[model samples]
Target: MSFPIELTAALTGASVNQLRRWSRAGLVTPEIRPSRPMLYSFRDLVALRSVCYLRSEVSLQKVKTAFSNLSEHDLTEHPAAYRFATDGTTVVVWNEDRFMDLVKNPGQFELVTINDVYRSFTNSSDRVVSDFEHPRENLSVAPDRIGGWPTIRGTRVPFDTIADLVADGDVTADEVPDFYPTVSPSAVADAVSFQEEVEGLAG
Candidate 1:
């Protein structure tokens, strides 16, 4: 399912620049040739969509990491199901009982109420979608040759503090996890692929 640049950008809500940036980030691999604009594949869109889902809906770095871990896992089991439908807004992939409790008592989930969290979550999801539409910058780095790695820039930050800033807006020096670090997109992909291979060994 190859898509033209325009269509892919529309569906993912990523801009041409952002798409290129992601490609540079090694998050998505698109086919670009000299004198040719760019081409995207369905798989690429799925990867970007997954990234967007992680940043928004869950709002928990660890949960996002778990989701990525699940993607790398060899388990063929389908993702856990919830009672409500997700229009790709706030994804709820918990077990049945936990989901039920969330829906019955929304405030427990940082939601005003379980009965109506669906709508609110979905609405807020639009921002991430839009980020894809109008990306801030184009690819800062060029794609690499075979066996090349992603180019990561920023420095590392503690996972706990990162999570706190992303979630509760509270950050204490002690809350920061000593081991949290940043990696290039290519590195992340490689690590994920390695994890997938390891999980495959159990089979």
Candidate 2:
């Protein structure tokens, strides 16, 4: 799921300038790397959103240190498959009933209550969604579905994938449902308008 820089910025709550800066610093390089058409994968999106959360609490240099710590632990699984928590100084990854301190202690963890995990995960996810100021009511994200890609609610189809069909002039607005039967014309129109607003902000 490769998304353009502008769209990625819109979804991740990171500015276009921020994304460029992070990429150059190797803090969160896009999965699809090109100066002219920067693109990022689903995992990159999760990482970037996590970066946004960390940035609110810590410095970018600290983020670099935390990521360096995380790398040593080997993040081979899908990012959405795990949960994240931080204290503005350290980063941790939680899966099931256990949590690992990725920053201050790279390979150490302890059992934690589900309530504690829920409190942290919701904080991160809430910011990821609310900070975007998304305009379309029909659009949504779910970690259990489509790796948390922004989609038309109740369906796995990405809103951008359908919006692109019109943005690139491959299909007319009315024809959107012809390609994605699950989405309505009005929903597609709103998504295109919202996407244009996002790209305009990047420009």
Candidate 3:
């Protein structure tokens, strides 16, 4: 399933504007672009995660260069699938067999290892996963399930979907349980209250 831009932004720590800019630049494009609303697949999210991490370590120009170099190599794997590292001077990618400094001759570098990049990527991915999985009380986000939205615990229903229904006044909190029998009335109320609290903070 594809995810909306808001969830993608939350998962990648990228602003909506940044995502738009990246899309325009051909740096990261969503899988589904059906006119008004854009949707990104999980692969796009993984690619964006790599882009953001690399950009943080080096300049965007260098990151772009690395991507170009990788494309030229005709690597079988996607750029995101490869491990990357930058020493503030050059970018290197692990081509499975060995590390190659894309800035220079795509050869081995003794100073850095794929382990370093792997560790950093793991930490960053963990934080992002944690943030998405537990953004608020009574809500859970499982990237492997439910399209990675803030869903009600123990159910696939998105909290925002239910909250929007109640906020529109078309469905009262008490009636929410009738529509979604899987969720309890208290859970529905919690969803409404959580949305209100979030809106209050945004205001």
The Cα error of candidate 1 at residue 184, in Å, is: 36
Off by over 4 Å in 1: 31-36, 58-68, 75-203
Error of 1 at 185 (Å): 32
The order of the candidates by lDDT, greatest first, is 2, 3, 1
Candidate 3: tens digits of C-alpha lDDT, residues 1-203: 68788767755657888888888787777867733487987667767766776788888888888877887777645555666667777788765455688875665554555445433332433222222345433567677766776788788898878888788788876788788887765566557655765786576
Question: lDDT tens digits, residues 1-203, model 2?
Answer: 58888767765668999999988887778777756689888668777877877788777777777676655667655453446667667767774456788767777885676534433242443322232323344577567777877788667878788788888787886787788888877567657755765676576
**96-199, model 1: which lDDT tens digit per residue?**
23332222232233223353332212232221111211111111122332222212223332222233332443533233333334533233322333233335
Comparing candidate 1 with candidate 3, which one achieves the higher lDDT? 3
Quick one: best lDDT, which candidate?
Answer: 2
Better of 1 and 2 by TM-score: 2
What TM-score quantifies how close candidate 2 is to the native fold? 0.54
User: Residue 147 in model 2: shift from native, Å?
Assistant: 25
Can you list the residue pairs that collide in candidate 1? 13-132, 13-133, 14-132, 14-133, 106-114
Q: Report the Cα lDDT for residue 89, model 2.
A: 74
Worst 10 residues of 1 by lDDT: 130-139
How far residue 172's Cα lies from its native spot in candidate 1, in Å, is 56
Task: For model 3, state the Cα shift of residue 71 in Å.
Answer: 1.4
